[model samples]
Target: MKNTLKISAITFIFSIGVLAQEIVDETLNTQVDANIPGVVAQKEIDNLDDQAKKLYYEFKDTVSEYEGLKRYDDQLEKIVFSQEDEIRDIIRQIDSLDNVNKEILPFLKETVDSLRKFVNLDMPFLKESRIARIDDLDSIILQSNVTTAEKFRKVFEAYQLEAALVIPLKHTRIYRA
Candidate 1:
């Protein structure tokens, strides 16, 4: 009789545990069904998040570009302002013609002297031609007839021509023959 009671108790507990497990499984299944749509929606949210990150990085790049452009513009404006000031000062100096002459005459003389020396020391291919240009500049630089602007222009022209020209090699034996 005691064995029969213990076996009955064991069977009853076992049946109750099975019933509870079935109820829990049914609840879990219902919850999983309810969350199926959310799982699908989460994928779309994740895609949107990826797009937002991509746009954020692009926005960062654009902002950096804008900042670089701003810095460049600021630097350009500074250069323009500085150049305008220099131009104004130059115009003021031009108004004082004597002062301009006093300042520029020595420099022009030195430039001519240096040019003559350079021509002499340079390759002899165009020696006479370059020296003649220097001499012409010297003559005009001091001439009262030539305007100072014209004198300076001629000097600059000569210097430009000298710098821009390509002198050919001297033919020693062939020219001598």
Candidate 2:
């Protein structure tokens, strides 16, 4: 009888251990599933950051070219107005300048539009980061001088914070509740 009781007690403990493990496994699986959407959202946020960086660089190049062209235009205007022997040459040069500007104008306009979109997309990330208590938000702002990855890291951190908040709620509300 003593041996039987001891065996029974051991069996009970083993069963309880097995049950606890099963429960834990289930919880872990649920958490993983719940986190999937947040992970996907974070990826989307990263993609937006990449697009923004591309646009920012494109805009910077366009502005630099535009400034150089403006300087050239000023010089050309002076030349065109100052001399008569080269009047035909001046007119031809002006026409060439107009053609170049015309070609560049559309590209510059497109870059500006892309920059605007990037700014709009970036705002949500900034707001989320500020909400998430991320330090260096100011430093991470897309200045003309900063590296793209630094800006991306800031944006990524914001998404991580948002995911941290959202994943738990999603798990509880969808699976446990």
Candidate 3:
């Protein structure tokens, strides 16, 4: 009887331990099931935070691009203003050239007339050819297609030739051979 009483006590204690373990396991499973929505909500919040950060960085980049474009626009405006000043200067120079052209032609024609008079009064050496050259210069001065600058060059060249002829005659003497 004593041995049976001890065996029954041991059996009662084992059964209570098993019942406590099952109760603990059931409570843990219930808590895990209830927390499922909270875990999913936390994951969604993290994903939204990541997307917000990405959009903020993109907005900053757009602002930086806008600033760069504004600087470029300012540089272009400066260049346009500078070009406007240059264009005005060019227009003034063109007007001045027109006045110079108008005044130089009459001066060149008078110079050719003076050269003819001087040659007529000078020595008889090569007189016919010199007269012919002066006539050619008169024709050149009257031509409408010739530029004033070209006419001036021709008249100056004729003076240089006459000077050369006079200088050589003064330096050397010619004898009949």
TM-score of each: 0.40, 0.44, 0.63
lDDT of each: 0.86, 0.67, 0.90
lDDT of 1 by residue, 102-140 (tens): 888888888888888877887676788888889888888
- Residue 105's C-alpha lDDT in candidate 2? 45
Off by over 4 Å in 2: 84-177
Candidate 1 collision pairs? none
How well does candidate 3 score on lDDT at residue 105? 80
Candidate 3 residues lying further than 4 Å off, grouped into runs, are: 1-44, 127-147, 172-177
lDDT of 3 by residue, 1-177 (tens): 888998898888888889988999898988898889889999999999999999999999999999999999999999999999999999999899889878888887888889899898887889999989899999999998988788889999999999988997777776769
Give model 1's TM-score versus the native structure: 0.40
Deviation from native of the Cα of residue 65 in model 3, angstroms: 3.3
Judged by TM-score relative to the true structure, which candidate is superior, 1 or 2? 2
Please provide, for model 2 over 1-177, each residue's C-alpha lDDT reduced to its tens digit, 9 standing for 90 to 100: 999999999999999999999999999999999999999999999999999999999999999999999999999888877776488788999899788756654544454444444445543535543433443444345254754445556555655665565556556544445
Question: lDDT-based ranking, best first?
Answer: 3, 1, 2
Q: State how far residue 135 of model 2 sits from its true place (Å).
A: 99
